[model samples]
Structures are given as structure tokens and as C-alpha cells.
Target: MATNPPSIFSDSRRKANRLRTLSLQAGISAPARFVLDDMVDDMAERLAFVRHEPEKVLVIGDYTGRMADEVLPHTASINAADLVGKHAIDLSRPFPVTGFDFVGVLGLLDTVNDLPGALIHLRQALAPGGMVIAMFAGSGSLPALRKAIYAAEPDRPAARMHPLVDTRAAAELLQRAGWKDPVVDSHDLTVRYRSMDRLIADLREQGLGNVLASPAPPLTRVGLDRARQAFMAEADEDGRVTETFSILTLSGRRSLAGT
Candidate 1:
């Protein structure tokens, strides 16, 4: 069994606040937002395909209420409701839910430290035959950033950005959580940015900044300069560098009547 940490939501909220502040300082603009918007659009399409129309739906890692709005109109006939209500849930703690027909977890599983336990909780909360759609960052995300970080400081590796749930691992997690017909797939989105600073800013604004359990020391002026150069080296003739995000999308169903 997984133990709930005290103040999980508070910790997450604090991190989000910090990222938002950094984003403002960095001056992120429309291009970054457009990439995220497209991702939400794809998620909405997939959720609409699930057979069950849950009266009450829980969207873990609902950040910014974007997915909720995208899904709401699609699920209107089913009268779906959002459990977290514009707030993120504490996955380390058991979610107090039952009889929900659907649960959509977007960009959450990759960052969770105790992913197996969290999946168990999600499985337990579903109604019979309830479906779960989970999306997470994959191993391939941030190739350019990773390379630049490594090249900038040979002694220090960039912090692991996310737990990086591969397809096989994700499928196993669903099975361990007692789900049936577990299905997993992945997609890639390449976001182009005018500059490295703008890319970092977008990450912060989207609440995807560094929150590693143990992050590297703050970048030194020299390191920052090198990193900036490395980023620019990767830029194309259009003066834009591409950040690749790999999203692993998984789905599964709880047994109609079983543990």
C-alpha cells in the first residue's frame, strides 16, 4: 500500500507558483501555448472514443483547466463532472472516489515518484468497466535540451525531467492496477522556439519546470552562456530550435465485477 505524504497538494501548488513566476520573467508567448492547445485537442478526441460516458470523471494533473474544458463539450450528453474542480489531486494519497465511469490522467504519470501505487489507486476508484486514459512524457522527450545540458557541463548530467513511462512499462502498470485490455501508444510533437530562453519560459508557464527531487545547482554564468550557445547551434536557418515532446497515451478498463 502507498502512504500519502502530508501536504502533497501544497507542495505541487508551490512548485506551480514558482514556475509561473519564472515564466513571467522569461516572457513566454503564443507559440508555446499553441503547442499545448493542440495536445489538449488530441486528448479530447481520444477521450470521446471511450465507450462509457462517466457521470463523474476525474482528470488527474488537470493543470490550467485546459483539458477539462476540451473534454466537457465532448462529454456534455453524459453530464460528466470534474472531481478535482480546477485543482490537482494528491496522487500519493488515495483518491476518494467510487463509481466513476472514466478517469483521464494527462501528463501526470511520468513525473509521479510512485507510479505503480498511483495506478493502483486509480484502478480501485473506477466503476465497473470504467476506462482510464493516461498520458505521460516518454523517454524521447527533450533530446536537444538533454544534449545541450550535457555538453555544457560534462561533470553534471541534467536532472531526470520525468520518470518517463515507456509503453511496455505503462502497460504493466495498468495490469498491476487490475485493469483489463490495457492499451498503450505514443505520439510526438515538435515545438519550435525562437530562443532557448523562450523555450524555458514556456516550460515554466506550463508548469513543467525542473522539480527534480535533487536538482543540479543553479547554472553558473559560464554554464548559462555555454548552454545558450549550444541551444543556438541547434537552431535552424529560421532562427528556431525544436523541442520534442513524446507523449505516451495509455488506456485500460476495470473488470465489471472483480478485485
Candidate 2:
């Protein structure tokens, strides 16, 4: 018997509720909560080049539900899956649906324990010659926030964020996962924040909060205060700290040959 992969995120944790909260908050505050929107927009724009309109599309990790909405116009049908609401499915496990003509993944791959396995499953879920496009927070992101979090516990800094995938590694993973014509691209978004609290709030609102199975204990009040101060230390002349989010996008098609 094949044993399952070691877990990184807590399966029992209320991830569904967390994602639902993110979607609800995003709908109420679109501009203030632009991360989901930005991710969907970027994926939609990149997908615009596909010549063949899909017959059926599966969208994974659509927190705001806009990705499927945008793709709906280009396809006959769309099936959306997130941790909660609509067609809720966890891509970290075997996908319930298969043979989709097109698959779009937004903001979900970074935290998976078996990223390579997830990629392989995604490809397997696709019909021959079907395509997949996935986007997530990649490497070289959140330097200022990382620094602040580290400074908060100079004695022992814990894992405040999940390890992110880089462009090169993503491309290689796609190929290893048996996808053809793999392409990996990345871009950085620099957002300015007035305070650390606001940034933390934004992360929670966007469903980017901690999902680690063995997450570190909550920081003490002193540690939090230090973090806030350290974040502010990175502020520019305008008194706003800059944080960068590196978005990596991967695209590829399943082989036509049923291997």
C-alpha cells in the first residue's frame, strides 16, 4: 500500500471557514482587498491567448469567485473549487473531477505539502491536450515583513510564512509532473502599508493566514510590539513601509498521448 505524504497543513483546521471569510470580505471591499482580484485578473489576461474555447473548465482556489466568472464567458461551463463555498475541493488530495478541458488555479499551491504530487494530480485531471494555469505567491516575497517577524524574536524566529516556490523550480516541477510546453513566469508587486497591523489584517482577509499543521505559538505582546517597530523601521521618506509580493505563474498542457 502507498502511504500518504507527510502533512504540512492541518487537515482538521477550519480552512473552509477561513476561505469563506476571505471571499466575503473581498466582495465587501474590492479595492482594499485587491489581492484576489489582481490574481484573477492576471490569470484571465494570460488565458486570453488560448485559441480554443473550452467546453468545460475547472477552477481551483478561486477565493473571490471572480476567476470562474471571468472564465465563464470563454467556456461553456465552469466548476469552481476552494476550501469552502461552491464546489469545495482540496487540491492537496486527489481531485474529485477529472478530464477538464481547462484548469485554472489561483492562490492555493504555495502551502501544499506535496507540491510535485499536486502538480501531477492536476495534470492527470486534465484531458489529453488540456491546459492548466496556476498562480501563487512565489519566492523572494515579503522581505520587509519577514525581517520584521524575525526581529520580533531575535532569540528564536519561528516559521511565520510558508516556503514559496520560485519560477525555475516551478517550471522543472511541471515538466517532472508530465506536462508539456511548461512555462514559468514571475512578477513582483510592491505595496506600501502604513502599519504592520493593517498588513496582518490584509493577510487574514485574503485567506493568506497561517495553515501550517504545527504552527508556532502566538507571539507575545512584547514580540508583536517589536515586530510593529521593526516593520516601521523599513518605512521610506513618506513614512510608508514597502512590501513585495512575488507572483509566479505556471502554464502547461497535458500530453496528447495517454502515457
lDDT for every model? 0.67, 0.81
lDDT of 1 by residue, 35-110 (tens): 3455567777876665445666776654446766656545533322322333436665677656667777756555
User: 1-259 in candidate 2: lDDT tens per residue?
Assistant: 9878778777555475365556667566453556667778887777776674678888877655776555556436788777666677777677888988888888778877788998998988898998888888899988999999999999989987777788889988988898888989998878999999988877777667778888899999999999999999999999999999888889999889843
**TM-score attained by model 1:** 0.81
Compute the lDDT of residue 158 as modeled in candidate 2.
Answer: 94
State in Å the error of residue 70, model 2: 3.1
Choose the strongest candidate by lDDT: 2
- What stretches of model 2 exceed 4 Å from their correct place? 1-4, 14-17, 23-32
Could you give me the TM-score of model 2 versus the true structure?
0.91
